[model samples]
Target: MVAAVTGLGLGLAALGPGLAPGFVLSYDMVFVPDPAFTRMTFGLTGVVPRHVPSDAFVTALAAVIPADVVQKLVLLAVFVMACTSAASLVPSRRLLPRLATGVCYAWNPFVAERLLLGQWALLLGYAALPWVVAAAPRAHEPGGTRRLARALLPAAIGGFAALTVSALTAVTVALATRGERRPRVVRVVVTAGVLSLPWLVPGLLRPAGVPGDGTAVGLFAARADTPFGTLGSLLALGGVWNGETVPRSYGAPVTATIWLLVVVVALAAYWRWGQERRGAVIAAMVGFVVASLGAVSPGGLEAVIDLWPGFAVLRDGQQYVAPLAVVVAVGLGLAADRAAEARWPGVAAAAMAVPVFLLPTLAWGAAGDLRAVQYPDDWARARHIIDGDPAQGDVLVLPWASYRSYSWNHGRRVLDPLPRYLHRRVIVDDAVTVDGTTVAPEDPRAVRLAPAARTGAPPAVTLRDEGVRYVVVDAEPGTIRPSGAATAVLRGADLVVYRIDGAAEATGDQVPVAPVAAAWAVASLFVFWSFVAPRTTLSIPLLGSIKPRDPHRRRTP
Candidate 1:
């Protein structure tokens, strides 16, 4: 209970006034007022299932409650789940050290950077990682896969990106643990593979898996944030790919030095006095090496991606540092426990406060970078008209790219919300440009339309020929309106919606049914069996036949 409240407090402090009713449309995070579940939501767009189950989950959940509210709940719940879950791993009887672990785990640079970048889905997998790692070793035992499924439910909702990190953690831990390696390794693969089917089935069914420019390897590599350089920043859990996502005033010499010292001390303490550190330490080291690969040797990563596009997952290397964050979180709790053993209560209290003190910018909405803003009323009007239409055709959002710096959204550069907001096949740019160099595009349609967007819109005859039923000009005032053949459907202060006359009806690509359905069926059965099976969260029959006792009990408290 205390851990949950501490998490809520940290969330309230970090998100600050931004938690007020409006949506926080920042970078990759896009939550609409009311999102319609299109064929694309279930991976029918056929390019990649990057959003997959996450988008589907949101659409269904929003059917009962508002999406804006759902977004807020998810963001807050991330902190709560992370805190309670990490606290459960501390193996301490006292509340102080466990609370220390929870706070350190919940309020760190990784969480702050990812939050500011608006990758809340990825953070969901990250929050559940502690349980995933802990429960993995027991997966070979009876009813073990069911429990593992429960641990992975959030990661499954997070789609491809989340599962990538989760798989890395589970596999490395399985390899490192002392036991019959084959069974543990097999369970890890089988369990994670089943939950991953929603995205995996689409990716494999497609001729190519994940498309993008090879240049993304260089663009998304971990970079130096502190004076200690990339290695130092990563060790401190602060080197995310995007600079804007890094918290304000972080990496300053004094702050970086103090934080680095704390990190070294905590890590050393864990090394000196610990059991079960072998698997976590190996996982963290492996994660650090993976995170550093692109930055240190981009050529190797480029070579790998050239061989197979699926390896492009390694491009945004900094996210792989998730296991390192878990290591540091657990290390902090171990250090605090050691301090209390030495009768230095002050040391333990200071350890609890250290994470908060080092990264003050994380509080109060990352110094106002995370403030929420209401969407213009014109957006809702546009959705209404589009939904009213019976014709099936694509909706093209113009200025023809993803990530809008809208005045209405307070100049926050957020992904264009049209794709998820509208009911039709919505086309917006999926290609990402970092520091002004265009990375290769994932969608061929977006690439084809890039030239059209660069100049004015394609001619209305061409638009009709291409099956564009609606072209939405969502530009701000003072932007030039290109002459085009489409009729103006609606003109509001916020946007101008143009209708392409006589456009042919368009149908979305067919997503494969059998494999995806089978995967979903297996995952559902696992979850259902998990519920029907007796709930056994304590130490199970695996891990040396010793029943794991609750960590809350202590010899001296």
Candidate 2:
């Protein structure tokens, strides 16, 4: 029933055409790779484990299906799960109210802008919010142990979804439990902490400073010039930092409509003021305030950014709007239920259609420009050529740029895809420096190659000295031009594999993969298994006997 409702709502919301069937290389979603490249790409992120789950998921899917198809399926699943989760949180059995909640949450402006921005991992985390919220109250219920254990599945899934959401979930759990239930909260926190070690361990073991510059904090901050602009955007769930991506069609009329709906839902919640609804209202308001603080209090946000460890990973504070989005969705459901009870069934029906009518541009892709693009045949051929070489040295990708503006990728700011394509270890210039502040590359070899690649000077001697066997020049015009004196072993339509003379014998400085990375990977598997494993199986024969049980405790049926 949930699937059917989600499919129907998404179809009505015009999500089909917007669903790209090929590579959508905007922003952070540019790390697509073939199945064989997954493990190598996994290590390329250095000791930081944040990209582990996303890389693993894509790699697992790529093993069976084409990577493009896998991406499309994953996106479709995100929409379905988001709608289903929101519907489950509605608490009402009425289909109209539940469907309204689903549509309001899944087809909002936030989802649209993020989809356009290509922040799939972040959106994946947003989709998990409703599930986490639904599971929170269960921690304090009768038979709360079993309930909390059940809740860990979603909590673990949320942790793997995005670090920010994981942290937020932990905070929510801590806040929800008090007095006698504090022990249950501790258990949940400990479980989440253990589950998060894959990414958390790497982040702690090798801490890199924040990615971008000071202006980044301001640019990505949530803006609120006016009450309507601030609260309306939050209510509509559309606090995207990039103004260019937002359509001009989303003008005052749409904003006013969204504001009206929000006002109606707010009044409904106030009128009822049930315990669960009161929590939702508080969470919604708090989320809005935090999200708005990024723009309103940039200085404060900057201080927090400097002080917080994992917090730096979340550049866009507008992502906190996710909690508000979930809250608003639940409110909409409740409002619809109230309207129906008041014998105004048509009002309930109208509320269901409000999101679709107000946020029209979000349908059929934001600004009507999101679609898939196939990679050139040369990319595959070049990968094959590079993989065929039995070399022991790293390959250097020219243009020496971390982000590429490729016409093939619709001029989106995407990370270079070469590192993920080639089987051989690669040395690509990933360091970015702005105003004396620099984010250094993981491999020092990348730093050394940057100067030569920048000057377009023949770096044959340097290549030999650094043990670089081959320089793979992406011969795309207007990018960096390679000038090394070398033998062109293979030349494709758009890429050239140059084998530097006298460098074949030089064993490059190979950075050893950290043993802790392997340990984290193995541990992550066990952690994931514990979440899915049966409770009976987890309680071992000897261990269960050794552990003391509460004699007065009543077993939950």
Candidate 3:
């Protein structure tokens, strides 16, 4: 429990301002006030289901609690679970080593970078890696499927990205510890596949056939975040592709060099004291290789995507470094044990503090980049307007851009949240421009409408053809061409809404919710049964084993 407290402390430090009641909006981390379910929430769209179950999961929680609170709770749970879970794997029985492991895992550069990038959903998987690793060998045991499913619950909520990472960790551990061709591997695969149906089915069923944009591989592949280059940055667990997401002052030669040295020392410690755990050693090697593959993506990646679109998940290879985090955390704890054994308890304590010291900027909510803020009143007004309308036509968000630096969000760049906040389908730009190269979007609507939204005029006629009845213009206003004097009669523009002549009912492909719902039901049964089921025996050392009393014997006192 000391380790758990330490973990909570690290979380409180990292989330200082973010612990406030408002939504902490930045990059991909978007939380609406009161999210409601929609077809889009179920990944029922023309594109791959990236947020599939994660959005749906959050919406369910929001039905009981405010979404912002749910966001904070989930974020806090990430740290608490990460810290405690990492500590659980240390070979040493000493408290110092456990504390060291908890701190090292909870406050590293990877967590900082991913948090700053606002991929909280991905972090949910990252945080749960230790638990998945612990559950790997036991997966071969009886009832292991249920146990594995419970360990994977957080990743299940995180959808595709998280589940993929967890799969790598679980399968690698199972293979390394227990030889392949075993039932454990089959059980692991089946469990992951069942939970994955929510997103998997939609991606397969997507009219675009999994929505692959080949250029994304080159655009999102890992890059150097330190003077030591891509390999060094990756070794130190900080090679996220987006340079802006690196923590403040982290790339300085001195700091980056210190971090690299720290990684080297941790690896040495693992080699000396913890390497015999074949699972950790093999998982680390596998993770590093996968990450390096993305850093130096071969020409075949795009071709591979041509053959199979799901392979596109490999584009963001840096996320695969998650397993390496587990190896390093346990290694650092082992190093602490060695230090204390050498009669240098202070050094052991110093090891516990080293991660936070090296990544100092993670404190106070990534140095205030993660502060909470209120959405504009106009946004609420717009939602109310959209929800009040009985007429059915898709809501199109304008500006032909994705991220916005809104004054209300303290000038932070966030993916437009209108689609998640509103009750009906709302389309926003999906194309992302990085380094003067625009990665094409996977959304069919974006492909079909972007051109007309950019260059077409006579707003009503342009939208009427596509069945768009209302348009939302946020921050970047006036992107839409005003209706000419001749066409003004059919167009109306208010605060953020552009009303036009309604067209035919919104027409497009949508994923069937039945399969995904049934998948969740199946996974939930395993998860629930994992907690409640037993052959029925409770034993205490001082007493004989006891069987569960039948309700018919309820009068027993």
Ranking by TM-score: 1, 3, 2
Instruction: Write down the lDDT of every candidate, Cα atoms only.
Output: 0.81, 0.62, 0.79
TM-score of 2: 0.83
* Candidate of highest lDDT: 1
Off by over 4 Å in 2: 7-21, 31-33, 37-40, 44-49, 140-161, 177-179, 207-215, 224-232, 251-274, 277-282, 429-445, 456-458, 490-493, 501-532, 537-557
Off by more than 4 A, model 3? 179-181, 456-458, 478-495, 536-557
- In candidate 3 the C-alpha lDDT for residue 267 amounts to 81
Of candidate 3, the 10-residue stretch with the lowest lDDT total is: 537-546
Ranking by lDDT: 1, 3, 2
1-557, model 2: which lDDT tens digit per residue? 86346745574344444455567676556545575643443443342344655666677778999887777766776677778878887767688888878877887777877777677777776766676666554443434434444444433433343545544654464465443345445444554555565555444444343233334566677654223676556556776776645544664664657555664664466447435644445555566777777677877767766676445545566777787777777777788888888889997788778877776776665545555677778778777776777755667887666767777766766667776677666677766443344555554456556777777554677887777777777646334434557777767666667787666543433323575467456556645544555453323233223333366899899
Per-residue lDDT tens digits of candidate 1, residues 167-217? 889889888888767777777777788788888887777544456556679
Q: What is the lDDT of candidate 3?
A: 0.79
Q: CA lDDT of 239 in candidate 3?
A: 90
Which pairs clash in model 3? none
